[model samples]
Target: MLEKPVNEAPLADVTPPRLEIRNLHRSFEGRAVVDDVSLRVMPGQVTCLLGPSGCGKSTTLRMIAGVEMQDSGQIFVDGKLICDTVFRVPPERREIGLMFQDFALFPHLSVADNVAYGLKGSKADKRARVEELLVRVDLLRFIDGYPHQLSGGEQQRVALARALAPKPRIMLMDEPFSGLDNRLRDGIRDETLAILKEEDTAVLLVTHEPDEAMRMADEIALMRDGKIVQQGAPYNVYTRPIDRASVAFFSDANMLTATVEGALAMTPFGRFLAPGVPDGTAVDIVFRPQHLRIDFDRAGQGPVPTPVDGTPARAVVERARFMGNESLVEFRLDHDGSIMKATVPAVFLPAKGKAMWLTIRRDRCFVFPSEGGA
Candidate 1:
């Protein structure tokens, strides 16, 4: 079990990263599964690899754990080489811990025995370690119980205890909270994060859920097509995405097409700056659903232009659904009959076929040159 330091020394700002990988690549069946992946995790920091399933996140984690070898690249810990093309280190000797969705506790072993499986020491030391980890995970009462005797949440805690018993320098977790019920997952994730921080272990977490990444990560590496498309803090990555796909990944996006003229793109929402783009270039004005504001129609007249919300565009309500704290309303654009969505806080249900004016917050919108355009 990992113990809190009695006299903890402050980490120097100049300390090197705990885990680093450079230009990692892996392939199977003639297709590249993990392509030129590279990332770093600082001591006590959690970096989440977030992307769609089959995007090679798990494969990348496996490569780091040395369960699978990379075709190329180098793995290092605190400036010391662990693996490269010519040199290699075994996974068991690397001092890294792993936790996965399936807790995979031994059904036959007692909770204390399972946690002590990877520990090496005298019997008393092992027992002490097991007891300490079980206590940290709030499962000390289950120490003598078999895996089958505990609930799913309790079993997961046992698995966590087992992983931390060895006091590894780095921890790799692949959707560790996925198996828990939704109501239970958040609390467990918080507890696990707290434990990892207390142990001062570097963490590389893999998850396809953006919310999970946002909540748990110190930094997020947004992966797609076997490559990291963007890496930054959650707020920066969400608000300053590099492309249309990156923006759409985190929320429902609404887009309007426009042609550039005089260094600006004219849309029903009004003109948006298209800086450095040549005239006649096609651009896509993208904004999130929550940024769209709904106003009642004054006969056929839409709302007046404002500095913040450029211009109100007319639309007919197609459908509306209550979503807890907000209502999602879909509208059919009057100008081109395109479907767009808007979110309104609280209960504001407008009838179907009712005309409403929708204005987008200019600061919340992004203008990107259309794909396949010059």
Candidate 2:
């Protein structure tokens, strides 16, 4: 027989998904709270469920953590089933760690004891683990201190160390940094992210703040009315929103309404391509406040059109206010008297009632079919 070529060994698969949820549903008084929610979190990745209040994000987290039973759903970890309508797994056995708004550290327990509470090993082994986590969190000096002796941010760090003591496969954090001051929150969040990435633990964070989601999440699931309306990377979710509400969720948005004809919607800004929208259908043009270009009015006439910024429109400054890094200028259009907002970087304060020229960036704007036909 001829010599056979040697076959290469197959590569071993790394850790399967750290967490997965399928068709999770929960209701309160016959009203669906978390309706058909599904998501996946891989090892070393952070998935943020972001939305406004009463959007069922917290409930979804609770179900995944096994704190609440889902009316119908399946929960899995590393390709192994953990929970479903028939089967059940207790919260402690699921290997899912939780960090909530309240630090919830035992007032009586020392910092070292708190971090070692969930660990199971000999005295030497548990002590080693506690010391390791305390050093990582930069709280080794407070190892013997009680929870009441630490600041809010320090308490939170201790809580985080305790949660990770057992090396949970999945971590669920519900507004964990909300208690910290604004300046401290930023630093704590970044430090926490680094530690979680080092541990390679999958994280599901719930927050109503858009900035928080954009800053921390690898993937954002935007929820509304107990349903996930959009899910994607932060840049994609902000740049290519599915609807008007989605755009407004991230930042302040301006709108222009026009009727579609020949697959084009004509507005005060310029003509916008309305492809796939039927002729005579109404369309709403949306853009962020930062997309508007401001120009000084000359002799009561606006600046000429350019390729980047389309036809200029005249408006009277209704109000202007300094907003730290930018100045917010509200205007009333000369044509329809409708209000619109624009943001100028640095210091560019215009007197109220001053005439100004505004041009919209056609490339940055989105035209969507209008439901109200306004």
Per-candidate clashes, comma-separated: 0, 0
lDDT of each: 0.92, 0.92
- Residues forming the 10-long window of minimal summed lDDT in candidate 2: 2-11
The positional error of residue 64 in candidate 2, measured at the CA in angstroms, is: 0.4
Q: How many residue pairs of model 2 clash at the backbone?
A: 0
| Per-model TM-score versus the true fold | 0.95, 0.95
lDDT by residue (35-103, candidate 1, tens digit) is: 999999999999999999999999999988989899999999887899988888999989999999999
TM-score, predicted candidate 1 vs. hidden true structure? 0.95
Q: List residue ranges in candidate 1 displaced over 4 A.
A: 1-13, 372-374
